[model samples]
Target: MADTALPGTRVKVPFAGQAVDGFVLARIAESEHPGRLQPLRRAVSAEPVLAPEIAELVGDVAARYAGTRSDVLRLAVPARHATTEKADSVPAGTVPPPDLAAWSTYEGSAALAGLAAGESPRLVWTVGPGDDGIELLADAAVATASAGRGALVCLPDVRDVARLDKALVQRLGKGRHVVLTADAGPAKRYAAFLAVARGAVRIVIGTRAAAFAPVHDLGLVAIWDDGDDLYAEPRAPYPHTREVLLLRAQRAETAVLLAAHARSVEAEYLVRSAWATSVALPRDEVRRRAAVSVTGDSDLDLARDPRARSSRLPKEVFEVLREALTVGPVLVQTPRAGYATRLACESCRTPASCPACHGPLRIGAAQAPPSCTWCGTVATGWSCPECGGRGLRAPVLGDRRTAEELGRAFPSIPVQTSSAERIIDRVRARPGIVVATPGAEPPAEGGYAAVVLLDTWLLLARSDLRAEEEALRRWLNAAALVGSTADRPGRVVAVGDPARGSLQALVRWDPAGFAQREIAERQEAHLPPASRVATLTGPAELLEGALAVLQLPAGAEVLGPVEVGDGSEEQRYVVRVPRTAGAQLSAALVALQASRSARKEQHLRVDVDPVTLG
Candidate 1:
C-alpha cells in the first residue's frame, strides 16, 4: 500500500451495484482493521480531475445546500470520455486586451481597474440591457488574462456562452481561451476541461458548471446575467452559480465581477452590506445608449373601450409597429410560445375546458378545435359549461399567435418567431416583425427599430417571489435591443400600467434604484434578500420528526406544512430565519441531515432561498 496516497487520487470503486470511477480520500496509515479493507480496484486517471480549490468548493457547496457531497461532486467533476484522454496539449498564445481604460472613466471602473492590476476587488456592475454587456464581460476576462492569471466567466446558458465566446475570440485571440459547456457533448466538453485543468488555457468561459472550472493561476471570477433562472442548478442541493462564485471569491481572495442588466436582490444585498462595490454608468450615458418608454392601455385610449383590454395588439401598439417598421424591424415580446395558451368562452367570459377530461383547453391554430392542455384531447363539440357558448376566445396569447396576427396585419412584410426549442441568434437589419418570447429574442444587426412589450400584467402575475423583479429584467433585455441614436433611434412601448414600480423603472432606465426599492420591500415582507428561508419536502411524519430535532436560531418563523399534490398524500413545510442566522440555519440543517443518515431516516428535500415557496 502506498503510505502517502491522498485526496483527489482517481480510482475505481464499488458504486450503485457496479464498479464505477471514483476518487481516493486518504491513506489509512493506522486503521484498526487494516486487513479487512478492500483493495482499490484501479486508478482512473493520471491527473486529478478537480484542483484543491474546486474540491474545497464542493465541500462548501454541499454543506451550504444541505446536499450530499457526492451530488455536488458529480456536478463539479463531470464524467470524462475516453476519447479525450489522449488529446494533445494546447500551446500558449496571447493578444492585447481591448482598451478598458476608457471604461475607467465610468462610475464603477476604478474598482475594475484595480482588479485588472491584480488586486482583489469585489464589485457588482450594472450595465443597461443590450449586447454591449458582451463586450464588457469579454474586456474583464481579457484584463484578468493580461494580468498573467487565469479567469473564469460564467453565463446563464449555452447561447450566452456562444455570444461571449465570439467576443472573447475576437478580443483575446484563439489559443489563450477555452469554453466549457455541455452543449459541446461529452468528448469535446471533457477535452476543454482537461485543457483548462492542465494549465494550457488561461481563460475559460462557460455556463453554470464552469463556475467550478479549475483554471490555473486563478485571479478573477465573473458572472453575467446572474439573475437568470438557468443559473439556478436544478439538481439536488440546487446551488446558484452566483453564490458559488461569491464563495470562490471569498475563499481564493480573487476579484469578483457580477454584471447584469437588472439587479437581483441578492446582488443588492451584497452592495448594501459593503461586501461589494457598485459600478454603473452615468444616467445621461445610459439614456444616450438606451431610449426606453412605458405605455399603457390608457395611453392608447383602449382603457375606455370595454373589449379593448383583451386585444393582443391595441391600436396604440399597432400604430407604433407601423411607424417603426418603416425604419427597421420591430420586435414584439410575448410571454409564452403557442397559438393560444388559454381559451375562454366568448359569451360567458368563462374559462373553456375539455368535456372529455375537464382540463384547461388551448387552441393550436385559429381554426383548430379546443384541445385540453393536460390530456391532449381535442374537444370538437365543446360547449362552455357555464353559458353553453359555442364560440371560443383567447384570453392569453402566445408568440405564435401574435406572429400570425401580425402577419395578417402586415401582409407585405415578414414575421419571424424565436423561442426555446427554435432560437434564432441574429436577424439582419430589415423591415419586418420579430415575435419572440422572453430570453429568446434574437439580436438585430442594426438593432430593432422599436419594441412592444405585451402582457406585462400576465408576466408579473406569477407566484414566484422574484416575479416582478424578473419581469422588469426580461423587459429591459428586450428593450435594450433597440438601436442607439447613432445607429437607429430606438423606442419602446410597454403594454401595462406605467405607475407600477417595475414599469416606472423601465421608463427611467434605473435597475439599481429599482433593486434598492425591491430590497426594502423584501425586508418589510421578510422575504429573501432580507431574511433567509428554507423549504423542506418529505413525508409528513418524517418532516415532523426532523423539525422536532432541528435547532433553529432565535426568532425563527415556521410557515406551514402545506398540502401538495392532488388533494392527497403529499405535503411540504417551510421555515424562515433571520438573515443574520442563515449560516447557523445551514449548519443546523447539515447536522440534522447527518443525524437522519445515522438513524437511517427517510430523506427530506431541503432548499434555501428557493425561487418559489408554493
Candidate 2:
C-alpha cells in the first residue's frame, strides 16, 4: 500500500496510536530521523487528484495570507466523493478555432492574439457598456483551447456562471468545457473536478472557488469584476480571488485578464506598476456607448429645478423615466432593499435606536413595527434617545419604498421589484418600472430604455473606506445593462451632487480615470493598493500579547487597539506598512500566531489586506 501511494494520493497512517488521513506531498529518498518511521496503514486511493502545480499554489497562498497550509488546501481542493471518483473519465472533445472579430472592437486586441499564439499577456480589461463580456470571455477561452491548453474563468455569482456556460456551449460545442460551482451538488462538482484532472475538459468556469480549478497545462486565468466583495473568501486567511490569480499567473507564466465594467484600485495599481496593460475603449467611444447625465451638473440646472437637492425624484429624473417608458422598460437602481432600513425622529430628525442593544431600528414594511437590525429585537413605542419625539420618519429609502412611491406616481405603469428575497432574472421590454437594488438588477429584454440611480447619498454616506469606490462600481454595473448606439444612445440619470468625484466619473463614463484618481488619493493617504495593512481582532489582552510578540518590519506603523462592537470586550488593531514590506508583515503575524499556539493561548484573528476596514 505504501509503495502504491504516489504524490497527491491519499493515505491513512498511525499517529499517536490513532489513524490519521493525509495527502502524500512527495516521496523522499531518505528520512532525517535516526529511528525507523512507521509504515502507512493503507492507501485511500491511487489517483493523483491534487496536481503538483495546485499543491505548490496552495502552499504559496497559505504563506501569502499567513494561514496554515491545511486551511488553504481545504479551499483549493473539495471534499472527496468516492462514487464520483470511481466513475470512468470521458474523452476530450476537439475545439474549433476562435474568431477574433470581437477583439477588433477594443484597442488591446494584441492580448487576445497573444493568447492565440500561446504567449502570456497580462491585461486589465475594462469592458465597455452595452457589451456582452461573457461572449468575449468565451472567445478567449476558445482561443486557448484551440492551442490545446486549458483555460479557467472565475465569475462573481451563479447567474454569471450560467450565462457564461451558455455562451461557451454556443461557441465551443458540448463537453468541451465543465462548470464548477458550489451550487452544483457535491457529486456533480467532484465529477467535473475529476474530468479536469483527467484532461477530459480544457475550459472551466465557475464562481469564487473555481479560481483554484486544477486545469492541466493552463494557458489563461480570467476573473470578471475583481472588485466584487464576493471574490473575498469568508473563511480563515481570507484569500482574495484576484491576488490568488495574480500569484498563479506570476508563478506559471500564464496569461491573465481581469475584466470588469469598473476598475478596482488594485487593478489600476497593476497597470501603473507595468505589471499589466490597460485595455479600454477610447473616450469618444465610451461617450457614444454610455449616455449619462447627473441631476445638478451646473448651477443653471440647479436653479431651474430647486427641488432637485431635497427631493428623491428630481424633475430631470422624472422626465428621463417618463420618456424612456414610452419606448421600453425603465430600471431604477436603489441603494437598499427593505422598506425602511433606517428610522429617525420626525420632529428633530434624530436617528432612532433600540433601547436594549442600542442598535439602529428599521421598519420592514408599511405599518410594521420597528426592529433592531443587529439583535432582531422588536422596538415597541420607540423614542429618540436624543430627543423626546415619538414620531418616526424614514430618512433612508429602500427599494421597496421607492417602488411603492413610483407606483403611486405612475399609477398606470406596473411596478416590479427585484431584491435578495426575490431576484428577477429577466424582464420583458415593455412600458413598466423595475425597481432593483444594486447587483440584483435583472437585464431587460432589448435592454432598458433608461436607468435611474436613486438614493445616491445613502451609498456615499457609509463609514467604510471604499464607500465611493463601491458606489461607482455598482452604478457602472447597473448602467451597463442599458443598450446604447450612435443614433439612439441609452439614457442614465443619477440623483446626486454632481460636484462629487464619483458622480462626476459616472457622468463622464470614466471608470479608469476614476480609479486612477482613487489610487493616487489612497497613495497620498498611505492606504491600500499603495501600502499594506493587517488587522488583528480579538480580546484586548490576546491582541496585545500577539502584538507584543510580533517583530515589526521597518517603516511599519501600529495604529490604535480600539474597542469594537457595541461595548464588547473585543478589540481591533491595525498595522500599516509600505507595499514592499507586505511579505515581512505577513511573516511576522504568522510567527506571532505560532507563538500563541505553542503557549496554548487564545489566538488573535489576523487578516492581511482585508477588504473592509469597518
Candidate 3:
C-alpha cells in the first residue's frame, strides 16, 4: 500500500447513494488501482484500512456492478475499528479445530466437504425457513483454520451475527473467534478488524461490511443469501456482497459458498459456468420434513369464496390458517410493510390515478389527497386512468391487511404483526397471527404451525427480469423460519396462484431446478446469466436521442427502445449484451453518459439483474 496519507489531491469521497468532494490522504507504493487513482483524503479507519486483497475484491465488484471504485470500497469497509495491533509473527502450521466432531457431522455433509477441500468459494443456495446449522457454518472457520487457512463469515444483520455468534461460542468456546459488524460501534468493530489483521483471531464473522476482513492465507468466503437486497449495500457505487465474495475468493484463490434455502439465477449461473457446484440435501428429507401445498393449483385453488383471490388472500387460506393455528403458531407472509400498502379505485380493477397527472395513486396519511408516486400530483375524485372507472385494487397485499384478516378470522387466538417498526425478537417470541413482510419474519417459537405464503403474485408481478428468482428467495426465507426437527417437518402453504415457476420450486422443494429453468429463459432471451442487461426508462423524446447515439461493439446487442409504463408514456429502453461484452458496453455508456436533453426529459436506471422485467 502507498503512503496514501499524503497532503493534497482531489479524492472521490464515498457516501450513501451520493458523492462528495474531498482530497487525498496519501499515496501508495504498490496500490490496487495504479491508474486514475489518488490517495485517501483522510483516514476513514484509525487502524489498517481495508486490506489490499479486499481492495482487489472491491475493484472486481465495482467492475461487475459498473459502479465507482471508491463506492465499492465504502461497501467493503463500512467502518474501521481501533485495534491497531500488527499481525503476530506466528510460523506456518495447521491449527486443530475446537469442535472437530460437530464440524464433520454437519448437514449438507457433501457440500461441507467440498468447502473443506478449498474449492474456489461458491455460494450455497437452499430454500425453507432459515435457522439450519448457522452455527455450524460459523464453526467451519475452525475446521478451515485447522487446515491452515483463514475464513470470513459475512452475515446480513446483527440479529444473524448474534444468532451465529451464540452457536460459535457454545460450540467453539467464546473468544475463540472474533465477531465484526457495523452495529458493534466503531471502537469495538475496529478492534475486531485488527484482531484478524494481526492474526489474533483467525475466524472472522461479521455483517455485510465484514466482506473486507483482512485475514491472510484466506480460504473460504460464505454469504447466507445472495439475493437479499440488504446485501446490495445502498451506496453510490452500489455493489452486492455476493459479487464481492466471488471476486475476493477468486483473487485469494479461496473457497466460496453462498448458503440459502432457495437458489438464485446468479447462483445457478455459478454452477452452470463451472464457477461453483450445487450443494443440497435429499428431496425426500425436505419433503418428509415439510408437506408443501400451493394454492391456485389447477387441481385445487379453492378460495373460501371459491372466486379466487388471484392475488389477495383467498378465503381457503383462512381455512388453512384456522387449522394450522389450532396445531401451533402460524406465519402469514405479505408483500408490503405498512398498514395499507396501496390505494385503488373501487369502480375499476385498474390502479387509481391522479387527477392532474395520469400517474398511479399511493396510500399514506388519509388526510393527504391521493397523489401520483411518479409525478406527485394531487388526484381529484378517485378514478382509473385506463377506464374513467371509479375502482382500483391493491393487487399486492400488505402485512397489516393480512394481519387484519387473520385477527378477524381467528378471533380466539392471540395475534401479532411484525414489520419494520417491530423488532425480530418480538415476532420470534409470538404464537398468534405473525403477519410479516418478506425477509422480516422472526424466528418462530415452536416452528410455525403453518406458514401461509400470501401475496405470491406480487413477487411474480414485478416488472424486473429476475422476478421469479427474487420471489423464490422471499418464499424460502419465510419457509426457513418454519422448520422443525428431523422427526417432524413444518407445514407451509401458499395462498396465491401456485401455477407460476416459483411455486414449482417451493412445492417440489427444488430451487436449483427452478433456477436452471429461469436461467435458460434469460439465456434464450439474451438476458442475464447468458447476457448482461441494463434498463433505462424515463421520457420518450429524450430516450429517442440517447438510443440513437449509443454505440456497441460487435458482440453486444441493444434490443430496446422498449417503453415502460403505459403505452402513452413511452418511458423505457432496455439494453442487452453477452457477459463478455461488458467492457465495451460500459465504455460506450461512459461516452454517452446522459446528456442535458436526456437528463431533463427522462430518467435512466442502470440495473444488471432487474428483478421485475414485466
Best by lDDT: 2
RMSD of each: 2.7, 2.1, 6.6
lDDT by residue (tens digit), candidate 2, 305-329: 9876668898888899889988899
Instruction: Specify the highest-TM-score model's number.
Output: 2
Q: What is the lDDT of residue 351 in candidate 2?
A: 87
The lDDT per prediction is: 0.83, 0.88, 0.66
Q: TM-scores across all candidates? A: 0.93, 0.95, 0.76
lDDT of 3 by residue, 39-126 (tens): 3334332344455666566657756665556666565554432243333323323455544354333245555655455544454645
lDDT at residue 508 of model 3 (Cα atoms): 85
**TM-score ranking from best candidate downward:** 2, 1, 3
Answer with 2 or 3, whichever has the higher lDDT.
2
Model 1 Cα lDDT, one tens digit per residue, 1-614:
25323466578777556787667655545877747666666677666676788888988998777787788988888687777877776756654656786566469788787756777788888876444687788888888888788889999888889999999878766777888886778988888888888888888999998888988889999999888989888988999999889888899988999888788888988999999999987887776776676555554555454444666566677778898888888899999899899999999889898787788999887788778999999888888789787998888988889998899999999999999979988998889989999999898987888889999999889987788899999998899888755654478889887778899999888888899999998889888878888898888998898899999999798888888766666678888888888988888888998899888888888998776677
What does the lDDT come to for candidate 1?
0.83
Q: Which ranges of candidate 2 are over 4 A from the true structure? A: 296-299, 354-359, 367-390
